[model samples]
Target: MGETGTEEAREFAHSIGPAFVKQYYTSLAGTSLSRHDAFYGNTSSFSCNGEPSILGAQKIKEQYVKLGFKEVLVDLEGGTFDFAPSHNGGVLVVVGGSMTFAGDKTCPFTQTFFLAPD
Candidate 1:
């Protein structure tokens, strides 16, 4: 809600980054979604039921559920960075959650996604 609160939350998230990474990988094993590992320009822009947006808000709800994460609360904190595409076919996404996963990771809600050309 407040900027200072978000900042503190982000710092706490950074402190626990490794744990979250481990948790994320462990969580990934139960779902169909694979982590994004490509570049940005070539990737299909993320869509929320058809609307285009960087912060998906609620796009991957089912995917996360399948992955076994509790639904994200509204005050979590996080950051996201776009990756450069490896070749010419896939899109790369890197999203991390803070203490609350509030910023771009889970508050608005989104995940790393790679869209490869068919």
Candidate 2:
């Protein structure tokens, strides 16, 4: 991406980051995965902690489903979104946050997303 394109991508990514995070946490509170799937593309990649990378949207959904969380409360005040333009005409977004689950257990997590226009 050129300088102007990169800046535009950055601004766009910044504008959507908060809404995306809100929708994502809302999806985690529900049973359906469709909303979550909409945030990722077919070629999207995901990784958490030191685990192996999960490639593709279907596999990513499967991985999330396997977590088996009935509900999640995101601590947005403690979260951060860092965005940049990628070489493939996509925005690379890195997010970090703390989440509380059913048993009052909490964990910090960081996730990377390669978001492209569809």
Candidate 3:
């Protein structure tokens, strides 16, 4: 990639961090299955909390709905992104945060994404 291309890639990568948080994590707290699905492709993969990775958008949606959290609040500490050569020029994004549940309990979280341009 040229300078402009790399710069665009970097910017694109940075943009996804907030967008993902808003679209997926934020909406998830509200239990919006459809909103969560919007951020993922058909073949997307998701894994967290040492559980088996869920493959495909449908499965991911099902898993989220099954959790049935009454409410969730994600407080993001921050995030960073970098190029992923192994993913065919995709970007690897990692975000750190804490999730507060309805019961007033909180747990630290780190989520990762391998994002490719559409």
Q: Which lDDT values do the candidates have, in the order given?
A: 0.40, 0.71, 0.66
Name the better of 1 and 3 by lDDT: 3
- Kindly report which residue pairs in candidate 2 clash with one another: none
Given candidate 3, what's the lDDT at residue 98?
A: 79
Please write out the lDDT profile of model 3 over residues 1-118, one tens digit for every residue. Answer: 2232466656755666556556656666665556677778888987867889898888887876665443677786564334332245566766677777777888777777776657
- Across 11-106, the per-residue lDDT of candidate 2 in tens digits comes to 776776666667777777676676777666777777766799888778888887776544666776758888776666556767888878777899
Better of 1 and 2 by lDDT: 2
Writing each residue's lDDT as its tens digit, candidate 1 over 62-90 gives 43453334433332234554443323433
The number of clashing residue pairs in each candidate reads 8, 0, 0
By summed lDDT, the worst window of 10 consecutive residues in model 3 runs over 79-88
Q: Model 2: residues >4 Å from true position, as ranges?
A: 1-6
Kindly report which residue stretches of model 1 are placed more than 4 angstroms away from their true locations once superposed: 1-63, 66-70, 74-78, 99-111
Off by over 4 Å in 3: 1-8, 68-70, 77-86
TM-scores for every predicted model: 0.28, 0.74, 0.72
